[model samples]
Target: MKSVILSSVLPLATVITAVVGIAGAASAAEPDKQFFQSAEGKWIGPGEIVAGKYKGTKFNCSFTGSTPDGKVGMSLDGGCRVGMFTQQMSAKIERKGREGYKGSFMGGATGSGLDIIGGNVVDARKVVFTINRNQLRGVMQARIPDDNSMTVTIAVRVDDQLVPVIGMSLKRVDAVEVGSIAPN
Candidate 1:
């Protein structure tokens, strides 16, 4: 009886292990995966006012470090003029999502505590975010096809239409490789 019992238990354990392994692999390959696995890095670019009333001016922007909780944070620094006045400002980007993200910005010349809403499109080699209504959009596309460098683009609305405002090229300074360790 002991021998027979041992034989049955061993086969059951093998079947269980195989099932678990298959489930783990399936989860890892699932589509519609949110949050990027390669977005943890530093990105710098220049922004321009291409639309609306302010159509010409350059601003510097940087995205540094991604939160462990799946949020990308960034900062913007630059100056521009609006109708006989020059101003300098700083802004921060908090989070990005399918519908959009929420963040706040401030400036020394006119507007302070301004809110930003945008949505991001992320793939293996590119990330793009669009802020509607404000007519502003940001894009980060790979430069060397498979390398770590990327080209960034910013577009804004002018006269109720969308137009490219600024463009910059950036390189990824760091990234974290992610993988599944267990079955979901």
Candidate 2:
């Protein structure tokens, strides 16, 4: 029963993890400490399955992102909801990655989840990762327009071209101390 649940939710977990992890791990000579720090904290977002067998299925996610004390990547732990179904998702990525570098994770079963085959930092605000699992391959791109928002896109290789599969828009969840007990 647990295996059944995991198998069913694996795809979604891969999508979310790839997007969040690759956003901070893709390298351009060195890891950007500022960029990694900026990605830490809470995030909430909505995502849609733009194409594939699950086309039109939409989900919302909330995550807490954290950077290792001085490592070169990010880790995210969170859950996503599709109607009443919820799945727990998490990813950990760390590397002094180079172009064509297989930004590998030390955890997880050898062939279970997606592997980051390669990645590149497009600019100060965007990074793209090549993701693969056996013959199935794809690209996940993360673009941060500001410290508070992020947009992620995932596309799969289809014959000769990449086809969009998932898209998500996420925003930082700022802590608000709106109410405090008065000391009388």
Candidate 3:
């Protein structure tokens, strides 16, 4: 009689603990979804590649697209010229899980594409991602300083060391609605 009672209570306690754990995990993911939802709309402004092979070259980047809560979709495009060399990239990012992304980046017009994986949101205002292929590894970070500005940094792994390669800043561009405009 004593052994049967003890066994019955142990299983009931274990089931209760598991249910609570699942509820806690579901609640924890709500904040991440809210964080991504806040960064909606288009951000357009000027920036520069302050490191790597393109240091001191000024350029403009435009970021457009908004991810609905619990979804992911964003793109980035930057172009600039230094002497006879031109640099540019076009990439699309999609949300992964509760706080991560995955995308592909195409460097320049005729360049081979790189795979973007392991993207994560470190906080409410920062997003990071990694790219790896063969012997090359790279990390990219996008941070928001305020409601109107963003900063991007890119780094690559070389000789077992991670080195800064690019830095960029952009400002949020508000969209204009047709119905909101009045005849001048």
Per-model lDDT? 0.34, 0.60, 0.46
Candidate 2's C-alpha lDDT?
0.60
Tens digits of lDDT, candidate 1, 105-178: 44211232234454333444444443322222332222223334455444444466545544444444444432
On TM-score, the candidate that comes out on top is 2
lDDT of 3: 0.46
Q: What residue runs in model 3 are displaced by over 4 Å at the alpha carbon?
A: 1-28, 68-70, 73-89, 97-100, 107-111, 176-184
Per-residue C-alpha lDDT of model 3 across residues 98-142, encoded as one tens digit per residue: 545555655311235555666666765666667654455667676
TM-score of each: 0.43, 0.75, 0.62
Q: Using TM-score, rank the candidates from best to worst.
A: 2, 3, 1
Residue 49, candidate 2: C-alpha displacement in angstroms = 0.2
**Candidate that would win on lDDT:** 2
Q: Can you list the residue pairs that collide in candidate 1?
A: 51-157, 51-158, 52-157, 52-158, 100-118
| For model 1, the run of ten residues with the poorest summed lDDT | 15-24
How well does model 1 score by local distance difference test? 0.34
Per-residue lDDT of model 2, residues 122-172, tens digit only: 655676777665566777777778767888787778899998777888877
